[model samples]
Target: MIKVDPDFITFEGIFAMLLSIKSKTSCGPDNIPNVFLRRYAESLARFLVEIFRSSLSQGIVPKDWLIARVVPVFKKGDNAIVTNYRPISLTVSCCKLMEHIISNYILNFLDERNILSPFQHGFRKGLSTTTQLITSIHSFSAVIDKSGQTDVVFIDFSKAFDRISHSKLIFKLNLLGLPSTIVNWIKSYLHSRVQFVDINGSHSDFLPVNSGVPQGSVLGPLLS
Candidate 1:
């Protein structure tokens, strides 16, 4: 078990995290753009640091931060059919700053402990899909040259992100021995989120989002 610093969310760390946010990204229902956040990042870092620390300690994420604006985009088939569209959430960027820092801490901790597999290539540092493809191709060629046959299998799931079971995810996280604080915090984050679907500039009534992580959140990929 690694003994990590309790006060990890420093002002400098917050500033660095804020600097990572793209200025032109779409804002959520808060209507507070990343550009607006970055403009005052120097000033907000101190305040955000405290909020992030409090959030971590309490394992209670701000309720307002959990809200999202879900926009449905047309997906190939008929635009008239509701099934032809996919829902994507635009979560608040300020809330995302905390997620970015938390994700960094989790990744660094896992890496330091050698928790991740060396063979894993997706969404990792110094690796890309192209690199994986080239390596795989070379391996296949070498095997073919040595013997005579090679076989490959591909498994693709449609909307795996949207389809994950919350309970199953929590179970897996616990099974993997993630910190209790992080698990509790993730539970708080995943529960009670509300989203309003925007259709033709008109929004549907607010609905409870009981499943899936916020689509565009920094934590989304991690949870999924």
Candidate 2:
């Protein structure tokens, strides 16, 4: 997750998050429509504040928030085959907003502590993929100028994010000296998730997801 530093979430923050939701977005499994949510943003924010605090102190998340709607989108190959599709999870919009708030806080915390190195490019501000590519080219060009020989190996980390263990993530968080409450909040967020795959308007039974971040959630990329 691209950790961010945000002060404690206030009523204003929650209101803003709720307002940011697009009115036409299809609701999650709970069927709480986005327009309805925005129409009562103030009241919803109040309730959400209570829910979040209760969750943090008790280290328990609402089952509704943990449930996801998984849709198999066809990418290539034969459309008739299940193997040709990729599963995408659509989580509750409210849960996503909460995750986004936490992401901001985590990022701010990391920035204050200088946890990320300056050379890091991916997901960082002021460093685009193009910028990094040009930097690498200049470095390699200089090397060719001096020795006339260059050897470079490019490694892909696409699947690495999906393969992370929760235990290791928790250990790393602990190593960073964050408060236990914050660490537990993260752990709770990562646990007991369930997703139901929808095919041709038919939804399969909810299946437990034991590993990896929930793609498309605000927390997913940052946590990754």
Candidate 3:
């Protein structure tokens, strides 16, 4: 995961982040919508900045921010198969704005240090699965052109996100040289998180989220 300087949460920064929110984003368990944030960004920026600063300074996220609403989205395969669906977590919009800012800082940190491998084509800006696939094809074609057959092996981990250990993730972040304050703040953000599955106007009992970053969060991909 990337690191951030909590000081980056300024009035202008918060205002810009609010404006960046897409109107179509679904509300989290807090029932706060993105369009409302964009509409009142000017009026709300100051208060949000204060709250963000306090949260970072104290190393404690607001309890409400830790809650998520999980919506299961179907993927290819039999509809009856539970594994065919992926959990899309909807979190508080205000909390996501802070995440966006922090993620940008972390990206900068990684870029400046040349920490991310050049071959990494997923998640990073300007890179995607399609790009990686194209690169692989080109490499294979070039090799075959010279009559040098290429052997390729693909491996996909099942429930990769669900298997991540929070303690180990924290340790990896520390080894990456992130500041102690930022690390502590991330710990607070990860722990005590609770979520309930929502489907067709029905909600399940709130379950404690102990491990793995949920999908559909600003920091989930970055953290993974």
**After best superposition, candidate 1 residue 215: deviation in angstroms?**
2.1
Tens digit of per-residue lDDT, candidate 2, span 137-175:
998999988987888888877555457788888899888
For model 3, the superposed segments whose C-alpha errors exceed 4 Å read 1-5
The per-prediction tally of clashing pairs is: 0, 14, 0
- Residue-by-residue lDDT tens digits, candidate 1, 1-224: 22234387799988877777788787888988788778888999988888888887777889998888888878797788887887788887767877876677777767787988876667666777888898888989999898968888899877777788888888987777777777777888888889898766799898988787777677887777
lDDT of each: 0.79, 0.77, 0.85
What are the TM-scores, per candidate, against the unseen true structure? Answer: 0.89, 0.81, 0.92
Of models 1 and 2, which has the larger TM-score? 1
lDDT per residue as tens, model 3, 129-173: 999989999999999999998987789977777777899999998
- Return the candidate ranking by lDDT, descending: 3, 1, 2
User: At residue 189, what lDDT does model 2 achieve?
Assistant: 80
Q: Which ten residues in a row have the lowest lDDT in candidate 3?
A: 1-10
lDDT of 2: 0.77
**Candidate that would win on TM-score:** 3
